[model samples]
Target: MCSNYDACTKPERLRMYFGVEPPPRIKSQVWPLYEAPFIRRHPHKDVGDDAVPAREAVAGLFGLIPHWAGEMTFGRRTYNARSETVAEKPSFRDAWRNGLHCIVPVECIYEPDWRGGKAMPTRIQRKDGKPIGIAGLWTSNTKATGDEVFSFTMLTVNADDHALFKHFHKPGDEKRMVVILREDQYDEWLDAPASRSMDFMRQFPAELLMATAEPDRGKKTR
Candidate 1:
């Protein structure tokens, strides 16, 4: 589903529009497409963070694949992981099992809808400028050529009243929203007992989210 939302061509322009400099992750890949804001703002960024290396020079494709998967054209670009069932998904099970640490940086993410036979898009973001730390699962994949591909999946939970019901309502379904973590809560999320990660992730506060539909300025590139 996230495939429909093209990466922001000039994600760095977010700084000019948002009036703040992006984090290292954001500064590095602000062109071609928009990535998660918190990822752009990650504080512990390095080639190998806690024994895990960056999958790509920058962010990898949004869809996540498990290390055991066989070669395929698309391999199913599953961008979002269901909070309720992440522990059971074939793709996300091991990463979570191995205690992989991941950060999904994002500024505003776009979603489209049709009303009165016309299309409209919503730009969702925090009212505050702080990047939303979307908790995720990451893994390392080795291609036939031997290039390592590091990938991640954003965990999803029911939307908050402010984000899901307030601004994200669509015709058929708006039941899902990406999980956003607070700075103080990041450690708990990253270090939570596997038994509790899903529970802790499902209850993201609603007040932190703020959004409105905009005539897509189409976030720009470097």
Candidate 2:
């Protein structure tokens, strides 16, 4: 699962890449519980008209905070939801059932390569150096202090048979990778219903991704 990643924080880049106006300020690096921007279908889009934009960008915590969560700390462990159990897990079921699909725009994703009997942080990005749009779920919650908080979680799929992602994680552990969507599928993914959302939860092509072994420099904090 991806717990840390480089976000596409520039407003102009976000506008061009995701087709939405992002928040004025967004962090470059995102960790669990960190603030980041996600693109989702406009809530009022159903009001009917081409005048309403189909998509909108909103800033939210990187992790997911279920409605039943008592505090923001609950998000720390909900950053990544397994596709197999997302619809059954307490932390993700509500969002999944409600079809709260979203796209998490990222410059690259960081994962650990556990070869050579040690762990090496690897930076994985598209071969073209373009931003990736990862599939995720978003939800809104009310805090004990009467503040409303929006949060999201990246959806992950089993990658045990994947050519590239199979090398990540521990030797015996199950391999997993985030669901990356193609540019053409962006709108389709957001508009997919709950029953069909899983159709997009598949691994990205290994040939389109390039990885470099770069150690974490303590620049990102949890």
Candidate 3:
């Protein structure tokens, strides 16, 4: 479950990698409710009478708020959706079934490691030190003033047996972590049918990940 992360990639870099228009400059770091870039499927009009689906990088809130939710506060608890129950959860079921998928790009993710029987802030990144894509679900909510709010929630999977991820959570709590998608699989994730999407929710390779501890910070929620 990734609640905060580094989004230090320059807008030009994102445009080159995702092939979408450059997004506005983002902060060096992002927390819940912060606006950041996420890639989603969009329609592209060609010369003829044909429209093709293309990936586009757009800015959106980190937490999702279904249109049906009455208050924005609900988003505070929806920064992450469990992979196993996403299809059944009320807040995410509609978006999941509607194929509202997106990819969260980040330089690294922050988590808490309890290996020392005390929470320690840790930053997890790709061993190659490149930006990674986190699988997520997105939706649009209309405010009473008619303004539309676009947001997303990262998908997470149990990591009880994962060598690196399993050490993040508390000793007695179930271990969980976000599903990091490989670069090659990003397109498929955005267009795949909901019925087959679950197949992609697998644990990230621990060997490909590197974790470094920072000074302990106050507890953060996922």
Q: Name the 10 consecutive residues with the lowest summed lDDT in model 2.
A: 213-222
**TM-score, candidate number 3:** 0.90
Task: Give per-residue CA lDDT, model 2, range 1-222, as digits (tens).
Answer: 999999888878788888888874568789998999899999999998888888988899999999878889898999999999999999999999999999999999999899967889899999997899999999999963368889999999999999999999999999999999999999999999999998998889999999999975466664
What's the CA error at residue 97 for candidate 1, in Å? 2.4
What TM-score goes with each of the models? 0.67, 0.95, 0.90
Best by TM-score: 2
Best by lDDT: 2
Off by over 4 Å in 1: 1-58, 72-76, 113-118, 160-170, 217-222
Instruction: Rank the candidate models, highest TM-score first.
Output: 2, 3, 1
Q: Rank the candidates by lDDT, best first.
A: 2, 3, 1
RMSD of each: 6.4, 1.5, 2.9
The local distance difference test score of each candidate is 0.54, 0.91, 0.82
Candidate 3 per-residue lDDT, tens place, 139-178, comes to 9888622678788899999999999998887788898999
Candidate 3, residue 69: lDDT: 79
- Tens-place lDDT per residue, model 1, 1-222, is 233332222445433332233333433232222333323223353545654422222455455656776552333555677777777878778777676756565665665545544546666667776655567776657852267765567777765353353344455665577776766665566556666766656545556666566775464554
Better of 1 and 2 by lDDT: 2
**Weakest lDDT window of 10 consecutive positions for candidate 1:** 32-41
